[model samples]
Target: MSVTIEILSGLGAKGPAAIVVEAQGKRLLLDAGGALHPDDTITWANNLDVDAVLISHDHIDHIGGVAELAENVPLYCTPLVAKALPHNRPWHPLPERGTLEVEGITVTTGQAGHSLGGVWLHLAVGNGVLYSGDACFESSVFPFDTPPKAAIALLDASYGSYDQPQAYCVQAISERLDQPLAFPVPETGRALEMALWLAKEADRRQLTLAIDPVIRDNLAALLALPATLRRPGLDHSIRSLLARQNACPPTLQLMCDRSDTPEQWPDHHLLHTGYLTPDRRAELAAGQISWQRWNVHLRASHLVALADQLGATQVVPLFTPFSDNALSAWHGLLGERLCTAQRLYAPSRLVTRSSLGSFACPQ
Candidate 1:
C-alpha cells in the first residue's frame, strides 16, 4: 500500500489546516482545520470519501475544523483530543483510535508528544511511509519514539532545525535573579516550563524564588504536569492536578519578585502578548518588568541530535518550505547520514541528495 501526501496548506494560510493522504485508493485526511491560508480554498470540503481522518492533536490548528470534517468523513484520534473538539451545531460524532482497512491499506497511529491527543501516522503496502505530524524528540514534557522498518519517513520539521539551547537566555535570566527582577513569559504552556525549571534550580541552590500571583496558577499547572504528563496530546495529568486542588483562586499575576510558599499561587503565566496594540507595548515596556520570550520548540542543535538518533540510511527534511541552512547544519552533524529531501510532492527533480554509495529505489 502506497500513500501520497498532499500538503494543502500550513502556517497561517487561508485554509487553516488540512493534509490529504491517499493510500491505495483510500483517503485519510489529517486535521480539517479553519482557514489555514489567508484565502480559504476549501479544497478538502468537497472530498467526502476519506476512509479515516487522524487528528494530530487538539490545538486550534489541528482540531478546529473537526466538527466540520465530521459532517463528511469518519475521524479517528485520541479520546482527549476528541473531547477537546469545539463545535456549535451539536451531535457531532467523536473519532478515536481503532484499526481499520481502506483500499487494501492498513492505517495505525501512535503518540506524538506535541499537545493533547497528538499523534503520528503510519500507512503501508510495499514501501511504507511514517507521517510525523509535529513531534519533539527531546522534550521535558514527553519524547515520542519512532517506528521500526519503514522505507520512507515523512517527518515534522517544524522545529527540525532546533539544535542548541539558549545559553545567552539562561545567563541573562540568572544575572537578573540576583536583584529583584521579573521574567515575563507566555501565560500558557512554555511559561510553566520556565517556572518549573527555575523552581527546581532555586530549591537545589537555596536561592530565593518567587512566582507572581498572576502566574501562581500557571506554576501550579507546571508542577502538576510532572505527575500526569505520561505521554503526548493529553493533559490528563493537569486535569487530575486541578481535581486535587482543594481551593484555587480565579487568577494569578506574578507581579512581585518574591518566591515563597506554594499556596501563594493562582494559575497561568504573564505573557507579553504581541496581539496587544502599540499603546499596550509602550505601557508594557515602560513598566519596570523583565520580559522573556522562550519557547519549548526544538532548537537547531536539537534537530542535529534528532538526525543522529535516527541514523537512518538516509536523512531527509519534509514539511519545511525552506531548509537549506538547516540541512547544511545537519550535514555537518550527520556526515554520511544527512541527505537532501525526496520530493514527495513537487515538480522539481524528485531526488535531492544521495550518499557516496546508495541504492536507487527498485522501479
Candidate 2:
C-alpha cells in the first residue's frame, strides 16, 4: 500500500497547522490549526472530510479550528489537551505515551517537550511517518522523548535556520531585566517553566516578582501529573514557587499572553518571548517593545538532530519562511533528505496492515 501526505496549510510560511494523510482507503487529519492573529481567517477546514482528527496539543494554532469540523467526526487528544477544546465537544483520550490503533492504523505517541501535555505522533504506514508538533529539546522542565524510526518526518521548523543555544538566550534576557519589565506568555507552554526560573532569579537579585493566578494554576496542574511527564529534579522548585505569594507593585511580572502594549504598562516595558504576531512584529521593528526568544520551538541544530534520529528519508520543514536564503541554509543542513513539496508519496516495501490490539496508557 502507498501513503499520500498533503499539507493544507502551515507550509512555506508561518501560519496555522493542518495536514491530511491517506492510506488503505482511510484518511486522518493530523491537526486543525486556526489563525495566529485575530484579523486573519482560516479556510482549510471548509468542506473537509476525514475518518478521524488527531490533535497534537492544546495550543490555539493546533486545536483552535475544531469547531469548523463536523461534530460527528471523531477527535482524539490527551486528556489535558481536551480541556482546551470548544465546550461540549466530545473527544477520545490519546495516550500521553504509548501505542494505540486508530482507524485500522497503528498510532504511537511520546512527549514533545514543548508544553504541559503535548505529544509527537508516529503512524505505522508506508515504512512509517512521524509528525513533530511544535517540539523542542532545551526546555528545563519538559523532557524530549526519543521517537521511533520513520521514512518521512513532518517537523516543526518555526525558527527556520536560526541556531541559538537556550543558555545564550537566557543570558541576553537577563541583561535587560535590570529595569521593570512585564512578560506575557502562554500560561500552559513556557509560562510554567519561566515562573520557576524567574522565582530563582528574583531571589538571587533581591527583586520583587509577581505571577498571574492562571499561571500558578497551570504549575499546579503540571505537578499533578505523573513524575515522569516532566524533567526530573525540578519538582522542588515548582512546589516552592507555588507556595510563594505574588508580589504587589512588583519589579517584574509574568502574566497570560494578550495584545499588550508598552503604554498599557506605563511602569514596565513589555518583553515578549515566543511567536510574534504581525502587529507585535511591527511594534518590535519600531522599538515599541523588546523581544527575545526562549527556545519554545526547535532550533536549526535540534531540527537536524531530530531528522537524523528519525532516520527520515523525506522531511518537510513546516511553519517557516521559504526564502532563498533560508532554503540555502536548510539545504546545507538537511542535504538530500530535505523535502519542500506540499504533497508527498512515501513508498515502502513493508505491508501497511497491522492487527488491532488493546491500547496502553502512560504510567
Candidate 3:
C-alpha cells in the first residue's frame, strides 16, 4: 500500500480532470484536460510522464489532452470513447470492459453514464483510491455501479449546490410537450447526463425529442455502455436497444434543426443552451414554443449524501483556484468537509507578452 496522490491539473471548478496517481514507485497521470479557471491558464501543450493515460470520458475538460497524450503515452479508454477523441490523435487504445495493467496498477473502466467512455478508476493502494469521474447518483435510467471498496474515494460532487429544482424542472419540462421547448445545453458531459433522464421521460410519456445533431452523434457512440455496465440494474428495455441500436439517446429519430418553427414540431421540444438567448426566445415564444433555462447540478443535500455514501469526510476541490465557483458553492454545502486544491496555476507569467498577445479567437 504505497500510494501518494497529488493534485495534477484539475483543482477548482474544473470537472473530471487530471490527477497524479503514484504508487509502488510508479506514477500514473489520470485525465489530463484543459483548465477552465478564471484566467484561462489551461495550456494545450505536451507535458506528462506516466506508463499510460486513462480517460474517464471524451469531454473537453476531461480529455482535452487526448491528442496531446497520444503523442506521448499509450492511451486507454472504452472503444466508444476512443472513437469520440480527436481524429488527429495516434492512440494505442485499451478498449472498454477490461483493465490496463501498467507498472502493477490495474486501471479498470466502469460505466459512468455521464458520457460514453465515462468511467471511474479503481486502484489498490495502502487501502485504495477509486476515482469517480463526473458521476451522478442512482436513477431509473442509470444506476450507481461505481466501486464500493474504495478506502479513498475521489468522487465527483460537481453539483455541490444548495438547491436546483430538479423535481420541478422534470415536471415543468414534461408539461411543455404540447409546446416546443428548446434546452440548448452544452453538447457533452453533464448535459448528456440530463438528456438521459429527459429521453426516458419522453419515452414514458410518448413525446418526441428534438436534439442537435452534434449532441445525437456524440451520444450514439456511448450507446454500448449499458451492455458493458451490467451492474446497477440498467433499464433492461432501453439498455437492450443501446446494444441493438442507438435508440435511448434517440439520435437516429431526433429532429435536428437550425430554424425555430415550433408549429411543425407541435408534439416535440428542442433542448439547447445559450443558443436560446433573449432575442431567439422571443421568436420561439409566439410559435407554441416554451423557453426556459435549466442548469443540472447537484444539490447540497445530494452532495453530502453522495459523499457520505462514498464514506468521504474530506472533499477536495479539483481544477479550480481558491476562488472558484465550485469551491465557493461547497462552502455552503460541506463547510468543514471541504478541502483546498493542491497546486494552482498562473500560466500568463510563464510565457512572453508578445506570445500572449497573438492569442486571438479565430473567425
Candidate 4:
C-alpha cells in the first residue's frame, strides 16, 4: 500500500493548520484551519471525502476550518478540544495513548505537549508515520509524555534552527519584571505555562499579576478537566502564585481573546509568545517595543534529537517557511534520509511504495 502526506496548510506561520494523510486508500484529515490572509484560500479538505479528522489541539487556527467540512465525518479530538468547538454534530473524544482503526489503518495518538490536550499521531501503515502536531518538548505547567517511535517523522520546527534553554526565556522575562510586562499568547498552548511562570516570578519579585479574562477562561477550562489528565496541582499552583487583583501597578499581564489596547498604564513592555513576522519585528524594532522570542514550538535541535531518539530514517519538516540553516542541520544529521515534502510526494519520485514501508526515502 502506498502512503502520501499532502500538506494542505500550515507550512508557514501565516497559513492555517491542516494535513491530509492518505494510505491504503484511507484518507485522514489532520486539522481544519482557515487561512490567515484574506486572499489566501483555505485547504481543499472540504472537497475531499475523508474518513476521519484528527484534531491536534483546540487552537482556533487548527479548528476554524472545521465549519467547512462535510457533515457526518467523524471528528476525533480530546475532550478539551471537543468542549471548545461548536458541536452541532457529534465529535469523538480521542483516548490517551489509544489506537483507533480508520478504514483498516491503525492510527495511534500520543500527547503533543504543546497545548492542554495536543496530540502527535503514529500512523501504522506501509512504514509507520509519526505526525508531530505543534509539539513542545518542555513546559513547567503542561504535562506531555515522551513521543513514540516511527519510521518516518513529520515534525514541527516553528523556530527554524534557533535553539536555547527554557531558562533563557524565563530569565529574559524576569529581568523585565522591573517594568510592566505584557505577554500575548494563544489561550490554549503556552498561556497557562507562561501565566503560572509569570505569576511565580512576579510574586518572587513582589510584583502584581493581572490576567486577561480570556486567559482566565482558558486556565479555568484546564482546571475543570480531570486532574489525572492535567498536571497535578496545576490549578492550585497557579492560584497560589497569582497576585491579588487589587494589587498595584508594574504588573504582569497575560493578554488574549481581544485585540484592543488599554487606555493607559505604566511604562509597559510587550513580549509576544509566538511566531513573529518580519513586518511585526520591524515595527517592534522601530518602535522600540519590548518583545521576547518566547514560544512552546519545537526548534530544529529538538526535532533532530527527537528523530534520533525515534531512530527515524526519514524526517519531514512541517510548519516551516524554509529555513536554510535548519534544513542544513537536518541534512547534516539525517544525510540522504532527510526528505523534503515535495520530494516525498513528487509524481516522478523514485521512492516506491515498498521502500516507504521499510524506512527509505527517494533520493
TM-score of each: 0.58, 0.95, 0.65, 0.84
Better of 1 and 2 by lDDT: 2
User: Model 4 lDDT vs. the true structure?
Assistant: 0.68
Q: Per-residue alpha-carbon lDDT of model 2 for 1-363, expressed as tens digits?
A: 689999999999988899999987789999899988898999999888899999999898999899999988999999989999999999999988888889988898888889989988888888789899989888888777777778899999999998888889999989988999999999889998899989999999999999999999989999999998888898899899999998989999999997787778999989999888888899899998999999889898888888887788988999998999989998999999999999999774443433322212111
Per-residue lDDT value at 343 in model 3? 35
Clashing pairs in 2: none
TM-score of 4: 0.84
Candidate 1 residue-wise lDDT at 48: 52
Per-residue lDDT of model 1, residues 301-322, tens digit only: 5444444433344444544445
Candidate 4 off by > 4 Å: 12-14, 37-40, 87-89, 226-228, 231-235, 239-250, 260-267, 277-279, 323-326, 343-363
> For residues 256-312, could you state the per-residue lDDT of candidate 4 as single tens digits?
734323222335666665665454566577764556766587766677777876667
Give residue 206's error in model 4 in angstroms.
Answer: 1.3
Output candidate 2 Cα RMSD. 3.9
lDDT of 2: 0.88
> What lDDT does the true structure give each of the candidates?
0.47, 0.88, 0.53, 0.68
- Locate the minimum summed-lDDT window of 10 residues in model 3: 352-361
Q: Give the Å shift of residue 255 in candidate 4.
A: 2.0
Q: Which ten residues in a row have the lowest lDDT in candidate 1?
A: 354-363
lDDT digits (tens) for residues 1-363 of candidate 3: 346676765555444377777777677777767543324545533455677677776656677656556465766666666766777565555544445576666565555545445666766554546677765443223334445344455656554453554555556655655544545455554444445666666677665554455655555544545543432344453343344333343421333334545555444455442224354567666654455434333345654665565455456644334556655677877677676646321111111111001111111
Q: lDDT winner among the candidates?
A: 2
Provide the RMSD of all predictions against the true structure, rounded to 1 decimal.
Answer: 9.6, 3.9, 11.2, 5.7
Q: Model 3: number of clashes?
A: 20
